[model samples]
Target: MRRSLAIGTALALAGALAFPSGAAPLFSGPTDDIGEDVELAPSSDYADLEDGELVVDLSAANPEAEGVNDDAVTGIADVFRVRYNGSQYAHVWLTHESEAVTFYAGGEPIESEATNVTLAPNESIAVGLRVDTTGETADGLLDEITVHARAADPEDVAAQGDALSFSGSTVQTRAPTETSRRFTVLGASAGETTTFDASRLALAGAAGDLTLDEVAVTSAGGSVSLAVDASGTEGARSRVAERGAEALGAVRVTVETGAVERATLRFSVPRGFFEARGVAPADLAVYREDGGELSRLDVERTGERDGRVRFAAETPGFSTFVVAADRARVRVADARLGQTTVAPGESASVTANVTNAGTAAGEQTVSVTVDGSVVAQRVVDVAAGDTANVSVPVERDDPGEYAVAVGGVDAGTLVVEAENETDAATAQSPENGSDEPVREPAGFGLRELLGLVALLALVAASLLLARRRPW
Candidate 1:
């Protein structure tokens, strides 16, 4: 019995060393001065996380000096370190703007893999850290993570002897942590009811056997009908009905383990659902459910709208979200017709300017009416608060006076006239209908009489010449 007790004690001590019991949180407060060498804040705000999963959180902000922008500090350098009871069970993954921030495991900057970020003096961006367990062994207690800040490079700081400040947080994981636990919503149809299988809920970590307590689906800023099937052999399933109005919303699923460890499942507002509700495809703001108001949630849009808007969200826990925007309204203006007069057998064109005087973009048809009858029409697409001219061609085959209108509004008139055949002929022949008569020369001048006598002499001479020729 003594030998067995000794072996058990040894194993327990070894396991404890591998997975420490007490560790700091996963985040630290902000470090204001990079030149000040300091220790990490040894407290954390996170209590639970799964293995092989990353939970990123914002660090606490350092108190700002009066009238000073803390983000203006130049050449800010960051160094990350993980402190534990001499076990490599956990590794710290650091990032800036979704890019890796570490070179090697020791918080060394990778020259090639480094992300060079420059923030404006007035602009600020938060650095992120992801506590990832190797999942090699369930050993945890990988406690404190310290992020050091400096005004210069590590080498320069070493050479120039500038100081650095650090902040830290504790990290805790559920015992026997699984690689991952995530839930997927499948077969969601936009503008229609969708049912998801509960049995297929992907559960990981120490609590793989997850039980659905309840499901509540509500619009972020709208309304929805949600139902959950808790009494099922496979697992808890969910069904969400279509929203009656166009708005952003989310479906939150509350789940529990046999030990009663609670976790919530959250998803972004599906774009297809919003589109089915007549929501225009514009930039949508994502918000996580807070107490009464929703807070912004960072998400990546998948740029696809099938039955649902597909997107990926990284968060510490499950929560509700709202994808929201102002609804757009479209309106048509009174149509105006231009250049309504034309001759017969010619085409007369009418132009009406279409305007969307509302906040929404839409298309409107502007028709041309001749003598209270629809003759020609055109479709005009106008953006919100914008206008476009729609042109319709009216053919005047016969002569008549036609009243022109657009969209039932009297705009102008179209007078088609046949060409005046009599005037046209008179213009072509000016002397055809003249009243003056033909007249001879006013006087027979001497030259005219001499010419006549010469003509008679020539006739007599020609006769004589002919007689002589015959002899």
Candidate 2:
């Protein structure tokens, strides 16, 4: 009996040593074993709402007593550990007791938290967690996280007894990325407020999609005001306006894309656009995808007022419109006349070179003026970066020197000659050998007198011949 008692004592010592102080009890409850596990219900994805909740089912169990495993009737207590990298985005809690939750930011206890949930053998308890994300930004949390759950004995002291413990975790839920729909704003005048449908700028949301909480001008010298409908059924409105010299600069408005896809945006024309370009609203031109091989689209004017032009076009994707004015600058390059000297009842040809010095293309009128009178005029059509020569015919029946001008600018001169008197005197008195000039009848030259004398002689000769001839 003494030997048997000694053996029994030694065996008990060995058992105690084998099951270390904080280790699980050797004879844990009835089933001779301590077991526990945890699981999450539904899914892990969660909305970034101000207040929310999650359900976690924690179970602990011990089989029926059998043979040497006669002590399988025991209770279990579960402890949970919650960790979030962005504590500001969410204040997390586990169970109904506020003290049980550990805040990651300040390491303070949450208002509704506690630990050590008691459970019977082969029993399970569902614990709910409340989360708050009011302080979170539109795109606060961008990664996935896990909430840890551990099961252990409620009364098990450190380094003592069978502390039945097991660990399970649930992925931290996250909101879905926002995508779908498009955005555009009607053109606006500088320093003036323009209204746009803020709802349209918003990305389409899924059933529980994560969306932008606010719309703002990221780099533009512009201000945006939001008007949210309290009824929740009406779309929001946004008013945007440019400030200072930024109206002449490139401005942009930005929103969070929920890290899903690229954002499409359209902006209104700022006020002072027409004044800055020195062009009328009707002269505005829009182009897109016109570089290289792409063709230009026909942009339609929506409206214009107060030196501001608003227009729209079919955009293939998100991009800024190529806006500009269509106009041309015309000038006279050169003026040339075919003949500077001519006789009476003659004409001279004049050519004027017109050039377009502007970026736009159009037609111009070129006119030739002799002695301040518009003698000839023609239309000259020239394209951008090109020159056109226009021709005009000038007639001068009087004898004199005349000044010529083309397109209202002085060009050159033209001279016309009158009938010669020396030739007429030589023909009338060939034998006189006189250097004196003789006055004759107006409109009667030497050729005319000679023709008249010949005609009179021929008539006399004909009469004599007729009289001599017999009937």
Candidate 3:
């Protein structure tokens, strides 16, 4: 019992050392076919594997011991190991059987070497089977085959009778080659993005897996692998890794450190809108998803403007878009203060609010005019991060329309008013505070002339008579 336990412990330790840790699971597929070959090898995926070794024991069922290989055996065994790559495995047996009659592999011919072996009721034997995954083959993961088997009689062979099977798995490896692949660019301008698909890569033409290294984008900002937050999927990864670089004006794609495989990729650049505002316009270059430039578009100056430009596309292969926001104008939108509204000869204050809704800001003038003449002006020093309010006072001499303007934009009329025209004094009417009687000026003068003539005649006649006598 001690010897048996020590042997089992040693086998377990050896098995543990042979396999390395931290690899994806082995035989990670459905176990469907566990036929005669299962008896040749016991495996975790025994129920799923199709090709392996198989052994049969038909002792009681076939009392004649007549079978396909002409082997009269109390037990049978098959073996499986070594899968792909250059890794090799110690001979591990694979088998299925009943202890009545038996079957064997293609090693011994009929009657030449007898396969009959004796065993006690519940006794078992360990067989060794090795396969060559030495180099690439048809299935592409295995080599040639070399297996070993032996049997010994212990007790009566008629004790055990039931179908038994076993199976296991191994690992192999392969080298990298050139191929094509599918890639995607997440950010791009609408007009500058392509809509290419996976079929365009055509990796099969390269006969192996494709790898892309040292990929760079014109707008990638000198960074590599522009997959935001390490979320690079099999479909694609950006060549430029600099933050927001994938949305820049240029990106370069190539195999910086690996092989190329043929594959198809489909992707698109993000939608973009460009606006022209303020004094200076912009000149921008646009690139397609395939890294091809379309054309340079010119944006013109629009006073106090607000608008956007949109782009869209659909292509067959992978694509990305990039936008260049070069030299665009910034502007503000707000009310323009005009002339103050006040009664004739009255003083009132004029005020205007300037709100910036653009990328740039500076001081602007608000000039107010009343009755076609400049009445007041205010110079508010505007800053990039601040809003300004301008206020000024003006004396209104007449009642008419007042005009207000800011940054060359005209704001309509402001009205000033005087008292009503219904109350007035006329020559024929006498009213309130005046007690004088109503009369025409010419008639009043005629009545006063007769009195003046009488007084003047009396004085003159006396003076004339005295002067004549003296002379």
282-348 per-residue lDDT for model 3 (tens digits): 3322223344323232322222212222222222222433333322122334444444456777755
Candidate 3 global CA lDDT score: 0.29
Tens-digit lDDT string for candidate 2 (1-471):
000000011111001101111111221232112211221121211111111112222111212111111122211122222221110112122222122122231233332324333222222232222223223221122121222223333443333334322221122212222222112111111233232333322222111111122222221211111122112111111110010010111112222111112222232344664565576655544333222222233546556544434454443432222333556667788887788999888988887789886546768777688898887667777886688888777878899999988997666888998868886566667376765566656878889899999999999999999999999
lDDT of 2 at 92: 26
Which candidate comes out best when scored by TM-score? 2
- Collision count for each candidate, in order: 17, 21, 82
Candidate 2, position 211, lDDT: 19
Model 2 backbone overlap count: 21
Q: Name the TM-score of candidate 2.
A: 0.33
Please say which candidate is ahead in TM-score: 1 or 2: 2
Runs of candidate 1 exceeding 4 Å displacement: 1-272, 280-334, 369-379, 407-409, 425-471
RMSD of each: 22.7, 22.4, 21.7
